[model samples]
Target: MSVEKPEGPGVIAEKLGAWIADVHASALPDRTVEIARLLLLDVTGLCIAGRGESYVRATLQATDPGGACTALGHAGSFSAFDAALINGTAAHGEDYDDTFEGGPVHSGAVVVPAVLAACEREGLGGEALLRGIAVGAELMCRLSLVAPRAIHSAGFHPTAVIGALAAAGGVAAALRLEARQTTSALGIAGSMAAGIIEYLAEGTSTKRMHAGWAAQSGIRAALMARGGFDGPRTVLEGKHGFFKAFAPSRAPDFSPVLETLGESWIMETIAFKPYACGTMTQPYIDCAIALAERGVQAEQIRDIVCEVGEGTVHRLWEELAVKHRPPTAYAAKFSTPFCMAVGFFDRKAGFGQFTEARIHDPAVLALAGKIRYVIDPDNEYPDNFTGHLRATLNDGTVQEVRQPHMRGGAREPLTGAELAQKFVDNAQHGGWNAALADEARGWCETVFGEPALGTIARFRQ
Candidate 1:
């Protein structure tokens, strides 16, 4: 069958492609490069930590392909595509990767794996890899802003939908493809973009795999374009384009995609997670931790009520009964009530807090059952993820706390020491010995200053 053409000419994809092709590491601002390095370090730790998850193990067993690229935690190497798929999955498996403040998409989980895999396969240097990552992240964040909440409203996961194109952009940069080739890659990626939000209903592992799948699709699209395959240049803004097909109810604003491409770096706004749960639930965890620090115990509380934004209700707060007693460990991460309860009882939320045993803890469940949310119409969401909490004591005393903004966002970024500790903690959690953990930490500390990613590719060793 012959494909129909988008009417007239399209400049959105062309502009993006030209920018990605021309940008290099030396041209990037110092802060942007530093953030990219930190993200790389953070995502590498997350991948290692996620390797032992049930879903990741199952995926590794099912697709045991061998090639030239390292798969992060695995002792063996795999094809660039398979490596990207597995590493991306590992990065996002625990929902601990960095999130773009604007799109809320897990940018590192998708872009990092694709860029790293391509760099490894092509023998590219660290500078090329870092530049590719920065470009890819900017594209993903901007694309998400084009339609705002349209993707989620249409029952699609923004990461999976927007990630494919972003991955293509990154991989194309890694390969140093020309503008025409990069544009073709992005156009091909549009056809590959797909991911439904159905995992929310059952709390399955499908959501964990979305980033990896998008990464694999992007590498394939970029490779196809390099091999002379042709695709539409208007895949993002033309008829039957990404937003038009995925979000029919909304009109996409194309300005974000091309406005201030070089002068402004959206990747700088990417936020690392303090908690292992959903992005929106991070601020609430802060509130719960604050309350716990104030000496509020589960036994001393009569009821816990949280005020949430209207936008978060459908995904995190609805189905009150189910949210209180989540069916699985993965499900509990998306359950605001469950996360709140865990935060209060443990005074922290991390990899250990999301285990199956902890999910069914009597004390946590008791507090979770008593938890409920009232929609705050004045709240900000899809812009700033904020949280508010209220606790009514058994003595008729009520205490309230509000997290004005997300902790790890641009307003309050993690310090260098904090980031280092996080990497060490993740390494320990992933079953690495003390020496290995320290070694990994040291490598990440100096990787940005190195000439090539030869050491990073061998991190599993």
Candidate 2:
């Protein structure tokens, strides 16, 4: 018996593919290019910082060492597939990579590693790299908007699932592939897309590898398409399409993805993280720090109350006791109370703040125990992440603080100086000196004009 196919092309894939094919390095806006450059720098630093992490180390151990692609800060070389996986994993291992404010999918962690690996393997140049990153990020951001929180609601990580398509679209644009092949790549990636939210249950390392898996899945899909593999054209909007499979609850609106593909750049709105924790936790960290500044000692606070978005209650505020005292440092990254306590006492939520040693500090845990949340129906999460903290001091005096928005979000972006320091700090955490970190930054700063990624080798130890 023969099987029936969808009648028309997946207009979603076709439109995305055509838009990607038409993008040129020279035609990109200065702001977009700048954002892409910073994204590259940020992800690169994050990869290096995560290289020594246990999860990343385990992933690196699973692969053999002989290929052209480079995994930042590692001496071993790997095939584009393995390298993209390894690098992508490292970039997101710490949950510190760039996040879209519209939702939580991480673009840089998934797209950069895939695009960079493809560029390096195919001998592509910096201009192609920049274009690829921009295209990939744009797609991921728009895709996140398609179903809003529905993906997470359906028990899947949006970045891990949506990232596969974004990476495919990105690499296709970077290499300037035929529009037909780009469509095939997206179709193929739909099959490769996967990652579960079960990691939230145990604080396992699975979430760290999701980005890597998606990255490698993208490379494989794109390569297969380039080699003449054909996939269903209507892979996105078919009877059993991507959204239907992953986000069954919502009816996806493709306008956010297609109508604004090029005219209004979504990548420009990408938010760089100030705190090395979950995206939702960033604003609350600001509130914690503010409370500390107001001379409200941790011990003096009877209990701290926060007005939070209901959507955040699951991954961030659930299992009340567990959220109060997360099992591991990785779990702590998602716990608003833990993040707030550490941010309050440390005055910052950098790499050092999430350490096992710091998380176990009695005072931090005690303060975290006192933190609780009340759901606010009007909270603007999955859109704007705002923070509200109302503290009842020991003397029964109430001190309240409201952080209108996340510090590193579009409204109040990180200064160049701040981003640079983050880069340097991430590099230092991975054992590179300030000088070496500066050199890598210089390369990211100017590689777009260069003929090829010749200096890329300097990143690996």
**Number of clashing residue pairs in every model?**
0, 0
Best by TM-score: 2
lDDT of 2 at 235: 79
The segments of candidate 1 whose C-alpha lies over 4 angstroms from its true place after superposition are 1-10, 448-451
TM-score of each: 0.96, 0.98
Where does candidate 2 stray beyond 4 Å? 1-10
What overall lDDT goes with each candidate model? 0.86, 0.90
TM-score computed on alpha carbons, candidate 2: 0.98
Error of 2 at 45 (Å): 0.7
Q: What would the per-residue lDDT of candidate 1 be over residues 340-447, giving only the tens digit for each residue?
A: 999988888898899899988999999898889898888778789888889999999998999988988998888888888888888777888778877777776676
lDDT of 1 at 422: 88
Worst 10 residues of 1 by lDDT: 2-11
